[model samples]
Target: MAPVTAVTEATRSWDPYERGCPSRDLLDRIGDKWSILVLGELAQHGTARFTQLRKRLEGVSEKMLTQTLRALERDGLVLRTVHAEVPVRVEYELTALGQTLREPLKVLTQWSMRHTTDVLAARERFDGRAGAV
Candidate 1:
C-alpha cells in the first residue's frame, strides 16, 4: 500500500499565477462589482433581507441580486437562513470565512473612492489622444 500524506499549508496554498487554479476563479468572484458591493453591504450591516439588500444596492435587478447571493453562498462566503414563520422570513449574513475578507474589501473600496477622479481624468485624456489620432 502507498504511504498516506497529511495536507500542509504549502499543499493548500493558492498560486493565482498558475493557470486553472481554484484561486483564479475565487479572485474572479470576489473581484466582481456585484460581489464586492454585496460583501460591503453585508460587512456594514451584519445581516440583511433580500428586499433590504436590493434597496441598498440600488440599480441591481432582482435576478442579478439573487444570482450574486447564490454565488456567494456557493463559495461559502455568505450564509443564507430561512426562518419558519408565518411570513417565512429569510436573511443573509457573512460567514466566518467571508468576515476575513471584510478588511481587505474595505481597503479596496477606499482606494477606489480615492482614485475615482484620477481614473476619470486619465480616461478623458486617453479618449482625447485617441480622437486626435
Candidate 2:
C-alpha cells in the first residue's frame, strides 16, 4: 500500500529530485513507464476488464499490471468495479483524479513520439551498432 500523505497541492518542496518526499512517491506511482501506459489505456477505453487491459498494453506481464492497478486503486486514482455473478468479473476505470493525469501523460506521449527515432539514431551512433538492446 502507498503511504498516506499529509501534504497536498503544489509547493516549492514538491520537486521529484529531492529524496524521500510525497512528490517522489507520486512520480513513482504515476510517472513510471508501466503506470503511464496503464493510465493511457484506461483513459482511451474508459472501462476495461483485466484481460482487456492486458491485451491493450502490449508487453506487460500479469504481475506488473496487477501491481499497477492495485497501487492506483489504493491511491484513489483508479476505480475497481467487481460484478458478482456466476463468474465474477472485474473492470478498471480512471477516477476524476486519474483523469487529471491524462494531460501530463499525453505530453509524455508526445515527447516520446517526437523523439523516438532521433533517440534510436543517437543510440545506434553511440553503440556503432543497430538494435543493441
Candidate 3:
C-alpha cells in the first residue's frame, strides 16, 4: 500500500473531495440539521437569545443548541455577545462571513421546502421496495 502524505494548510489546495481535506469537517458541521437551522434562524431574525433560538428551533435540545452555537462562534460564522446587566444577557448573531452564507442557505431552505413532498414520496417508495425485498 502507498503511504499517504499530509499536505500543509498553506500549500494544500482545498478540495472537499480530497480524503484529508479540512473542508470535509466544515461541510459536515454546516450540513448538520441543527447547524443549518441555527444559521437560518439567526440570518432571518438578527440577534437572538439562547432561549429564543431554542424555542424557534423545535426538537433541538439545550445541549445541542449550546454546542452548535459554540461551534459557529468558533468558526467565525457567528458572534457571541455578553452584556452586563442585572441578570446579564447573552445573544448570538451572525458575523460578516456568516452573512455571506445567507443567500446560499436561503436557497437551500427554499429547495428543501419545495421538494419536501417529492422527497417524502421517494422515501416511501424506496422503503416499500426495501420491505418487499
Residue lDDT tens for model 2, 10-111: 534566787776778987788778889989989878999999999888999999999999999998889999999769999999999999998888898999
Tell me the TM-score of model 2: 0.82
What would the per-residue lDDT of candidate 1 be over residues 1-133, giving only the tens digit for each residue?
Answer: 9999988877887889999988999999999999999999999998999999999999999999999999999999999999999899999999999999999999999999999999999999999999999
- Highest-lDDT candidate: 1
lDDT of 3 at 3: 100
Question: Which pairs in model 2 have colliding backbones?
Answer: none
- Global lDDT of each model? 0.97, 0.89, 0.96
Ranking by lDDT: 1, 3, 2
Query: Of 1 and 3, which scores higher on TM-score?
Result: 1
Best by TM-score: 1
| Candidate 1's TM-score | 0.92
Which residue runs of candidate 1 sit more than 4 Å off their true CA positions? 1-10
TM-score against native, each model:
0.92, 0.82, 0.90
Model 3 lDDT-worst window of ten: 4-13
Clashes of 3: 0
- Which is superior by TM-score, 1 or 2? 1
